[model samples]
Target: EPEVTQTPSHQVTQMGQEVILRCVPISNHLYFYWYRQILGQKVEFLVSFYNNEISEKSEIFDDQFSVERPDGSNFTLKIRSTKLEDSAMYFCASSEETLDQPQHFGDGTRLSIL
Candidate 1:
């Protein structure tokens, strides 16, 4: 079966540098989302995108963050300035629909802020 894939499973970054996490969602799915989990916190939704525009976003998605579907198969999340609080597991998910579809998540990109 096809699955979501993420790159650089683990990354260690400086406190103020930029980082881009990459993901490739399931080919036929239309809804994509990004969520982050702090070491001992709940998964927090960052943003959801469909039809090439943002569908919904949470307060966590601030000015320093951005997302893009640079190509037909690749989705990316960019953080302009990393902070210590940014250390967390970033998961990329996709589903056939939002209302009742269960999302499939990648193993995740574990970001470490220094």
Candidate 2:
């Protein structure tokens, strides 16, 4: 079955550098999201996108972060400047148009900043 997929499963980056985490959601899904798990903390929602526009975003998604659907099949999350506190497991998810549908998540991209 088709599922969400992420690239560069493990990313190690330097502080103040830029990082872009990539994701490919299920082909037919209509809604997309980006979330992060900071070490032992709960998963936090970053943003949601649909029809190439941001549907909603959390306060944690500050000016340093951005999301895009650069093409038909790929969705991406970019951190303009990496910080040590930014280290986390970033997950990409998607769901069908219906709100009741469960969102499918990728294995996640583990980002470690130093």
Candidate 3:
């Protein structure tokens, strides 16, 4: 079965720097999402995108964060002015056709901020 894939499985960055995480969700999925899990914490929803527009976003997704589907197959999450608290395992996910479906997630991009 096809699965989501994230680039740079691990990333180390300085605090206040910018970071862009890349993901390629399942080809046939229609709903895409970005989530993060701080070490030893539960996964938290960040944002969701569908049909080229943002469907929903959580409080954690502030002006500093953005999501884009630059092309047919690539979806990305960009965090501007990264903070130490932003360090977490970022995950990309996709659902077949609706939010009700189970989302398949990538292995995750472990971000480390100093």
Candidate 4:
């Protein structure tokens, strides 16, 4: 089965540096989402995109963040400036239809901001 894949399973960066987290969503899915989980917190939705434009974004997706489908297969999230609070497991997910359907998640890119 096709599955979402994320790069650099773990990443450590200093505060204020830019970081680009990469993912390849399932080939046939139209809805993609980004979510984050702080150490022991519940998963929080960051943003969702479809048709090359943002469909929805949570308050957590502030000015420092942006996402793009750089190619037919790759999706990326860029953080203009990282903060300590940004440390979390950033998960990339995709579903065949909508949020009502179950989403498949990558192992995740663990961003560690220090």
Q: What are the models' TM-scores?
A: 0.97, 0.97, 0.97, 0.97
Candidate 3 positional error at 84, Å:
0.3
Model 4 vs. true fold: TM: 0.97
Q: Any residue pairs clashing in model 3, and if so which?
A: none
Residue pairs whose backbone atoms clash in candidate 4: none
**Residue 101 miss distance in model 4 (angstroms):** 2.0
How many residue pairs clash in each candidate at the backbone level?
Answer: 0, 0, 0, 0
lDDT of 1: 0.96
lDDT of 2 by residue, 1-114 (tens): 998999989999999999999999999999999999999999999999999999999999999999999999999999999999999999999999747889899999999999
Residue-by-residue lDDT tens digits, candidate 4, 14-108: 99999999999999999999999999999999999999999999999999999999999999999999999999999999988884889999999
| Number of the candidate with higher TM-score, 2 or 4 | 2
lDDT of 3: 0.96
Q: Which residue pairs show backbone clashes in model 1?
A: none
> Can you write out model 3's per-residue Cα lDDT over 26-46, one digit (the tens) per residue?
999999999999999999999
Give the TM-score (vs. native) of candidate 1.
0.97
